[model samples]
Target: MGDLSGRTALVTGASRGIGRAIAERLAADGARVAVHYGGNEAAAKETVAAIGEERAFAVRADLSTPDAVDTLFARLDEEFDGLDILVNNAAIATSSDFENTTSEEFERIFTVNVQAPFFITQRALSRLRDGGRIVNISSGVTRIAMPEIITYSMTKGALDTFSRTLAQQLGPRGITVNTVAPGIIDTDVNASWLRGNPEAEAAAAARAALGRVGRPEDVADVVAFIASDDARWITADWIDVTGGSDL
Candidate 1:
């Protein structure tokens, strides 16, 4: 419903899962998309193919490294001189109890999930044109509090703060910053247990008021709106794509 013709967007971790869906959606809306991948060149190429290589290209960078972050921007500058929309959707999840989480694990997750995005946005400020949109793909765990991924949740909480603060900081430039938190999505990550297992699938579906597990497209649609000019007034907020879970 939103038009993005002639615009340019970047979607991190877009090789597969929700990120891939977001890339496809933006491309559908007529924005040239750059699909960022950590190390999956094959998957990235596949996504580009799905969106049409002429309209989509793949960029690779290990977000956990600061140098890699710089490299990513450098490559983006070469691929597209300016960016109209940025979706920070790349993240890693780890399951560890409060008593058992290791220092290394904590740092690794934060580096990839939190630190990278923090700097990525910082560096992107120059490349991001005025009136651009910044959409961070946060997680619903921030509100629901699943201890298994407490660290992951904490990272998203920090990202939420970043979004709110950046929204205000960049308002003068007409840039809108927001976060999209998705619930249990039926992606490859969840297919291991949520697919073909009626009991597991039913249990997951019961968690949402919609009585069904979410798909990547559900979140992608919302992101597409936030990226469009239509959502110019919506910022500094978190759009919960949780199917009303725990509500």
Candidate 2:
């Protein structure tokens, strides 16, 4: 664990899956976390309870909406005197064949995956203390370009670029931004495939050098490193957390 006793962090998509794991990881390191969830208030509260209310709080914000982001930060500011870590982990996607992919579907994924993180960082900059860390959750699909989830891959690819560029822009401010791209993970988002479809899960697992699907904690560990002082020299870099699948 790193020394983060006085730091405060905001983690989006914290109601479940990788986001919840990241929030827990940060809290374990002693940072007070604002657990942001788009839906499922009960699940979000459960995350806070697991991490302890003294170290984590449940916050709700619909990232797909333009105005709700600012509203989210406004509440975060009211709770923490200064924000030290900003984790843009909130994202959404739907499975569809290329011909079946609709403009609405693509737009929805991009809005929440790309636009939300960009704007949320912009909106929350005022509260991000100097030397703070901003870690964006990306996907291995950007590198492997998964065929089934093409649109989702596109959104994550954009995030990799945004992480690099934003790091340069925030360099002068002493804030560092980086992206952590994870491979197929065993989470509720993927529970159907892992639980009911053994054949599908095995095929997915074969792609990873680890010989298994990733766990939420696997990705969370990488995010924690990027947010740590050990990575102070790293900026504008996209660190792959995909269990050697990209290789």
Candidate 3:
């Protein structure tokens, strides 16, 4: 049996991209996974199918809504008795720069990327088992200067702070709260600019010390390990899954 054979994990935004990869990896490790999606029911179902219907289920909640956390956990309560891992991976980004970013855009980004995760975890605490895991998916932009997505980077920074502080408070319960920051990965989100554009892809690859752009699975594997029993002592840490980008 896998180390997480009996565990149950909730991976937000598991409908696509890095979230989907994390959900698949967790399921492979023998955890029953709740594949949470913002609005894409089809993609969420595809994720479940990929992981096997028996091992995964889809839950939908538009995290931009104020009651999103309640809606999410209400659905979750119907499926699992308790949660062993919570992966806060749902987020949205805007390309608007500092000067162009409007109040509405900033609010929307913060609402989905920061507020949703915060409240979701707050509600999850009671359902989370004592020795549970909380993995917040952050971004390398928080470390590297990306002026184009300055607002997005700010949200990640807030998430990183949340992870560290929450880790300290939840230590007594044996709950580990940490953040995983990923560099550029070749996902659909980056497809418009990075996929067919050979020059752009090459430039992104060169930034990494590994001389290659990261894949969703690259970050997923690290998260799988962090969620396992092997990483019980690891908490409140920001683990970089950037493939040594800009290092």
Candidate 4:
């Protein structure tokens, strides 16, 4: 049996990109995973198919709405008796820089990225089993200066703080809360600017000490370890999966 055999995990935004990778990895580790998506039902189905129908199912919720947490957990309740892992990997980013970022854009980003995860966790506490794992997907932008995505970085920073504080509170219940921050991952989200553009990709790769761009699996592998029993003693820490970026 795998390290996470018989466990149940909820990976938000698992329809694509890093979230999809994490969902697949967790399923490979023998955890039945709830693949949560914002609106892409087709992509969610693909994720489930990749993980095997028996081991994965898709749940949809537009996290920007106030009742999203309730909606998500209500569906989740129908599938699993309790949750062993909660990966808060759902988030959105805007291209607008600090000067061009309107108040509306800022609010929207914060609502989906920060508020959703906060309320989702609060509601999940009751369903989360003792000795459960909570992994939040943050970004290296929180540490590196990226003014173009300042608002996005701010949301991740808040998430990091949440992980640390929540870890202390949940320790009594044997729940471990930690954040994984990724850098320069080559996913569809970055395809528009980094995929075909060799110069941009080269620049990004050079920033990392490893001299290569990161992949979704790079982050997923770290998350799988963090979610496993081996990481029970590790909590409230920001583990960087950045390929030694800016080091």
Q: Which candidate, 1 or 3, would have the higher lDDT against the true structure?
A: 3
- What is the C-alpha lDDT profile of model 3 across 198-219, one tens digit per residue? 9999999999999999999999
TM-score of each: 0.98, 0.96, 0.98, 0.98
TM-score of 4: 0.98
RMSD of each: 0.9, 1.2, 1.0, 1.0
lDDT of 2: 0.88
Q: lDDT tens digits, residues 206-225, model 2? A: 88887888899999888888
Query: lDDT of each structure?
Result: 0.92, 0.88, 0.94, 0.94
Model 1 lDDT tens row, 90-180: 9995557777889998899899988998898998899899999999999889889788778888889999998999999999999999999
lDDT: worst 10-residue window of model 3 = 1-10
Score residue 117 of candidate 1 by CA lDDT.
88
CA deviation > 4 Å runs, candidate 2 = none
Off by over 4 Å in 1: none
Better of 2 and 3 by TM-score: 3
Q: For residues 61-118, could you state the per-residue lDDT of candidate 4 as single tens digits?
A: 9999888988899899999999999999999955488889999989999999999999
RMSD (CA, Å), candidate 3 to true, equals 1.0
